[model samples]
Target chain A: MRHFVFSLFTLLLACGAQAELRVFATVPEWAALARELGGDRVKVYSATSAFQDPHRIEAKPSLLAQARQANLVVAAGAELEVGWLPLVLRDSGNAAIQPGRPGYFEAAACVDRLEVPSVVDRAHGDVHAAGNPHIHLDPHRVQKVAEALAARLAEVDAPNAATYQANLKAFSGKWQAAIARWEREGAPLKGVGVLVHHASFTYLTHWLGMKELGTLEPKPGIEPTSGQLSGLLARQQAAPARMVLRTAYNPEGPSQWIAGKSGTPAVLLPYTVGGTPAAKDLVGLFDDTLQRLLQAVR
Target chain B: MQKRIAMAAMLAATFGAQAADHSELAAIRAQIDDMKRAYEQRIAALEQKLAQAESRPAAKPAPATVQSERTDSRRPAAGPASGFNPEVSLILQGQYKNMKDVPERGITGFWPAGGHDHGEGAIEGISKRGFSVDHTELVLAANIDPYWRGQAIIAAIDGTAEVEEAWFQSLGLGHGIGLKGGRFRSGIGYLNEQHPHMWDFADAPLMYRALFGNHGSYTNDGVQLKWLAPTDTFIELGAEMGRGANFPGTDRNKNGSGAAAVFAHVGGEVGVSNSWRAGVSYLTTQAKSRAAHFAGTVDDEVEGLFDGRSQNFIADLVWKWAPNGNPKYQNFKFQTEYFQRREKGDLTCATPEGAAATVACDGMLSAYRTRQSGWYAQGVYQFTPNWRAGLRYEQLDSGRRDFGDNAAYLVVDSYRPKKASAMIDYSWSEFSRVRLQYAQDKSMFGITDNQVTVQYIMSLGAHGAHKF
Candidate 1:
């Protein structure tokens, strides 16, 4: 039948289109990094986005669909996506991207890691002591992820290895320059004190020699209760901490409460790109984040 | 750590006093013990790092300071279970309305055609209300270990507030067998097990609301068992004996009848492709009839015997398609479900024409039969991370019935009428929804009622399980 022939033709076209390597990333930052390295040859998507709280994303039907179609799945492992991604992948039956599979990419794997906690206690909050999952905020580590992704893309798409290599080189050069500029900008801010949620920005804070006073969350991923907030307020009133830092997605209520109870400014920073207009991309994300922190501290 | 150990000892003492009755909190403590072990391992790792750094040469003093600072950074604001998390969420929305026939309907008015009648005919003053807490709910969930998980839910509206789900789950059983018991939602169906906290819509679907009753067949006094098969598939079988719904103000010792229900469900998903499931359920009970005493506008109080039964079967399938790495956005998601039901027996008395009967069925008995089926297809597409749209079309029909073929019979008008309904809804974000839907219904059996409703939904809470 003519319909059957048309269907076969469409199927053939789809098969041909599938030649472009498919790569899945758990968040936009990693997806962006993969795209920069793989260029036109790889299709990338994130399990969560700049606007979403990576900690509490729901594994909905649509997300499962993406997991099903993925050829290579990337995520900020170390328990960042532990809440739902595991269920999604296990239910998706995507053996290709199952944990420990070659197609499975844990972006944190490449880092000379920090935040490797010696203790694992949930009494404070759910802990992913493997390492801090938020590493892309550090330019040097982000470059490492880019290099790994390029190598992986080359292995999957050998014909486009040269293109991926060139892309990685360009990305590294640009990243190196940006890091130098940030270092220079951060020269005078060493040991500057601040408070935040968990160790979400440990790499960035450590890079700038920012002395962390404490965290707003009594525990990782837990909200600041009234009693805890009051305690922090008491501490803030006494010590006059330079700044209170928070991600864009964190509830404004706790931050607002701390600000009202204590004469302190809560610096709402863009935790990822596209979270705010000022944080349009990786470079803009850091630039805007550092600028906001600098302004608050000053 | 000492405080925790003392508390654990005190809890163990309390549990020893009440040996038989399982204390949910005690089980949670055991689970926390496991998490404590994991935390201790991390602590050991950090201690080793610190020891190594401290033992290093004087030339590496800078590195040691950095290492100490990094260790300090890993510490959380909360000491242990203190001020660790405070969850909050917000939702605001509105409802637009247009009612046919009556310009105004109160909460107690008789329902127009194609609407569900709860305890009475639809009431008055219900149509014009703009927006309210349609889907706002709060959740605090914690897992102590493999054998215990604790959860609490609070809604903006409904009956007196009480703990909705408080139970302990056991996973260290034979062959992946798990046990659950306590005040929990009966795992009667795919949707029922998925608490209202997990629904995509502000209101449940019409078929579910109709047959199962609004609030969807929630009852107390139950136990459940789940078996995970080797192929990564799971089967759940459960039962419960609880107080039935009929006369609102009856005591458990009086005309209350024992109701028995049974159900089984199995399903799983593969890759990013699709998920499928099938289920069957049956429930039956005896009904007690009574005559009017103080309010004798009707017939004499008659003691009668009646049996009621209901059976349901369902098949469902879901498919999601998105290319790898792009999870923030999905091109499409598809879900479809088919359900069927059978019911028999009735308790109704004859009434004269042109006259409404407040009391008519004295020692009068009637028989009735019901056959129904329906299906629905729903999909959602995320245009961007902050925005998404959804569409759903649901259809249900209760076939025509036959009573005594006499006008005097109670439910005479509804003895042979069919009921059909359909709803379409769209939702935005994880917290809000706006819905518009229509239905056509006919049933004097008190089982047939229909009406159109424009509903709005809003939610506040930590993330709930997804519909995938």
Candidate 2:
């Protein structure tokens, strides 16, 4: 009888805990943005961390558990999580958060995507047919996504619409100012050349007007062979880039290898909101990234 | 007015003299026009050629430029979906196994232990002592539309291919109801549905081997329905009905519908990094004359036929912890499962007619009753980004056995089998891993086998996510 009472008590507690809107975000950057918009109205969970590669993750039971109760699901859905997110959503068994619902949001859908392949072929390696999903790196794009997401949060939770709108207004003002400041401070890197670990920083470079030298992995998902590395090295030597750029989640060995060979400044940029110690929020994310790029140029 | 008239008259006189000059001027004008037309045509042709060349590289370098986006600010989207290409993937596995000895061919006094025989060339978990290609799996999966998705897995072992799993699941079944039909792995225990490619260690647990051979009693040819409760806290109830063709079952079901199972699971999170889930499942099957062949040394082999009803119960629990729910650098997972099986049936034992028989029983029928139970517990720690270590312990108990009149004639040993295993693996990335595992197996009555295995699993192309 006591065991039954204890079990009933715990079950009630669980039910009470789940009354708040539960949001499951695929990556941390979106989680941060959602938190800023939803405030205390929603409990946010991120499936992947800043340190983990977003392309692949084990769809663990905990993630499914979180998603099963989620009121909203957010993802950078240009096949960035093609490996796992679809499966996770399907298994979550939550009808409200399924695709095409107001409770579901794909940030990539709102952005004018970059790199839409004109032709169809798999020889180029793993490519997103919906274009690049790494739009969070650009402050301007992130601001647009934030606005859309805030509206989404409001629509999902009608009672919190005012709070969501207020949050968006404050965020937009602060973010636009930060972008202007970053542009002014980062003017010197406009025409500077760079090598990168992957195309993760494409939006960042596009925003800054950096001259792209090349990539270690010329194919998006394939590892660079020795011959490919040597070719990259030759190109870098002939026309030296000022910096070798990589994300916090990328492997350090390959980027450092060529950086060491070419004496280029190796820059590890915080790719997301929580990617680095200083990058604790959306504003700090851009500040830390611009600062890192400036250090590399210097 | 007089000066204008004088100038007009002079112009006319000059014109009369220069009429031939005017014709020559007309000829020159025509020539200049022709030359201009010719040059314009040539320039147009060259411009077309230049455009063609430039467009060729643009079409080809769309992917290259996306990668080289370090400088240029061109945002290129990778076109639209070209029809549908099913996600195709290939998994290759190979292993080298070393055991203290060949080990006993037949398990001592284990019931319903059919389908455990390793083929002539099989090597990884239960086969031989030398190097061998374990198995290669080809998988194809895709969404049929918004309402359904399908997947097929084919495994090739020893140069022969067999269909492993082929199923279609409903996509738009609302209200947390998911329906699937066709051949699929049963969602009974936590690991039952997981393929060998995703196993933590080099081999399966001893309980699995003794219960339903190397492959657990997982794959079923039938339909399943699952319902995730409308409430929170992750409660799911599932049930299955299958054609009784697999072990613990046989092909003797003339009317079919020989097996059925039901399961329920609940999970919750404790903090930022800790989560746990527990479940209970039950499976029941009716068998008629299920055939089992036990290999004995030097032609003492025997074949047994079982006819009976089998009931199995499983309880599983899994716990996971990572510092902040990201297992990139470090994480820990502990999983354990207990299973109890009950079977009451009649067995017909027979010996080969030709060679040398230890004790000749051409064909003898006996009424039998047997009960068995087993459990396995394992823990894995991801010490670093690329390295992991795991330990597993397993034990199986042959509870009780009764053979009516043939009890004295039958050679059955009363023994419990137990084993312990430890392994460490390194993963280069998500697609490849190499694992080294060691085990001390004591399944036979009086002999113990110390085993070592080095295995490699490589995945190429796309394999859909195996669910949590």
Candidate 3:
């Protein structure tokens, strides 16, 4: 009888193995941020990996299935998935993580937005009309997102409230320190030359105080035509934007061509977390990207 | 001696039981009892010496039962705990097509060239050409939650439109019956219902072109009614209406109409495994076209247009024969669809044949009768998860089928109309497309022509629907 009771107790103990906090992130960097804030208490999952393009993802049945099961969802919002994500969430029918819910967190909302346009136009291809949505590159912005996320997580899991608060406190300190270092190191980038795809790098340029050199793509979503490339080539010959900045996911052909023709150095930045091997996580992304650019300029 | 040893064993057992309850106080008590017990021989010796020298009454000791009773109240209660959940996923879609002179055109205003006349006179050709945002779209979706979902879609003809999807759903609706109204595409037909990000071409099938006019898988206007049917296998039915936008010399027909469609689908494989769906739709418009004449440059030549009605029926069938029970055979699948449409009356015309040299002719009739149908058979073989090759053959015609044109526009046009087309295309994901198509077009006005179109499309997940 004693052995029987002991076995039942053991079964109950097995059933009580600690539950984990569910965290869903749009990119690897967001997932990494959640992990740093959550530590051992949370489990993180990312929708986009380093190898894929964040801008053109397909919402599949399997993805809806995933969204249906998430506890908290974090994304880079502001018209990024204007065409697709709405359909996915509508299809998933998951009520808890829907926008405006306690579990929903848009990274853009946590940061000070840049490149906000005065007008919205569709003639030049798909324009955010709102501005650039990628905010993970800015440490200050990421810290803000982390703080908001921590507060949200605490609302539901008050039992671990102190742990989450402590984690955020430590994370923000490290984040601010990194920002100060990067701002100083990236000082040389002020007034540096740059050519980019779309207005994707407007936030980065504004943050770094770089010169507004323009872009290689003719319009927001258009591929550069030969004429457009030639126009850019001519401009480069006269003014010479020294760095042709391309994200790892953006097509390299046009940037490479412009670089070859104009003799500008093409720098592939980790546009989002997991865009490069060195940027394996959120913090690692900003570190490696800043270090690479600083070294190149030096 | 045996009694003493038994008492010692009893003391050890009592202390062991105490350890099972309150260890903090029990540990201290156990140490005191053990020391007292250990020094019993010395205490007895000292007591005997004391008795020999002098005597005093021994102090009474407390009962052992009191210690045993205190163990029950000190056990720890279980800690309160909760839980968390995570969602993760990936979706990919790609296609290839053959475009041979199947000149993709837009839906123009009621042109006398495309419509037929049953006598009377002719309505002159009003419009030159049609335009459409037709292309093959590929969509890749990875969503983890309401706040974090990524969509990457690309298409050949129109390029790509990708966006971050983060919105709240199920805001209202307590009862089973409720609205799923939001910024979502309304349910239309078999192909339109499926994302182009998951399609088989850089262009839609020919039948889709014939029915929807210029807006393929037409979108706009919002709000939908979703009904949950009582069934074992997931069954849902929805209906929606949207405002159609127009461009150019045509009036901005913002007086949009309402469209309602019904779908019945069953999923779950059997035998060779098949997914079969059939849907019917009827779209009616109260929208009126701005009255105008076909003359190159006419002054105030306004005409009153008709309010029209179009109805469609579609049946789709997909058969899967997997290899070694592998489901990835979506890369190796055979599918086909047959679509039919019947359209009638949206305008009135003065029948010149019935008039005694004019001067007394009001509009003779208010409607036209037209029937059209088309079908296509397509097959796809996916070589890799990211790469797929597909082939499709489709034909469409606008003719006097079972229903002949009896309207004044057809009568005035003196129309003899027929159009035959064949389309083939190869697509690569949503980002690129190379299409070739050919069409033989003959109108009621004795104008015969052939058109061939070869086009290339590339997209950068900018803003586009998924390619199915």
User: Candidate 2 local accuracy as lDDT?
Assistant: 0.76
User: Candidate 1 versus the native: TM-score?
Assistant: 0.50
Docking class of 1: incorrect
Interface RMSD of each: 11.0, 8.8, 26.4
Per-residue lDDT for B1-468 in model 2, tens only?
999999999999898779978899999999999998677546544543443233211112222222222211112122344336887889999888887654344456675344434333223333567787866899998778767789999988765788999999876776778899999999898888888888998877777766666565468899999988755477889999999577777666376588899999888677757778899999888877676554443235666667898888999999988766656668899999999988888877766344465445446788878888889999999987679999999988878877665555555567888889999999866678999999988877777888899999988875567666
Q: lDDT by residue for model 1 over B1-468, one digit each (tens)?
A: 999999999999888867744566678787898898677656656654653334211112222222222222112211222233633333333355443343222111111221223223332223333333343445665444533445555544344454555665542343434466665665555566565534544345545554454554344444555544433354445555444442111114644344555676565445533444555655554333311111122332222223345455555555555433233444455666666666556544433222344445544667645566666666666554334456666655555444332114332122333334344455444445556644444422334334565666565433434544
Q: Which stretches of candidate 1 lie over 4 Å from their true place?
A: A1-19, A116-119, A260-263, B1-369, B372-468
Give per-residue CA lDDT, model 2, range A50-86, as digits (tens).
8777875667666776777788888877778777778
TM-score for each model? 0.50, 0.76, 0.51
**Better-scoring candidate (lDDT), 1 or 3:** 1
State the TM-score for model 3. 0.51
Chain B TM-score, one value per candidate, order as shown: 0.60, 0.79, 0.49
- Residue A85 displacement in candidate 2 (angstroms): 1.3
| Candidate with the larger DockQ of 1 and 2 | 2
Q: Give the range of the ten consecutive residues with the poorest summed lDDT in model 2 chain B.
A: B55-64
- Candidate 3 residue B69 C-alpha distance from true site, Å: 63
* Deviation from native of the Cα of residue B256 in model 3, angstroms: 28
Output the lDDT of residue B376, model 3.
71
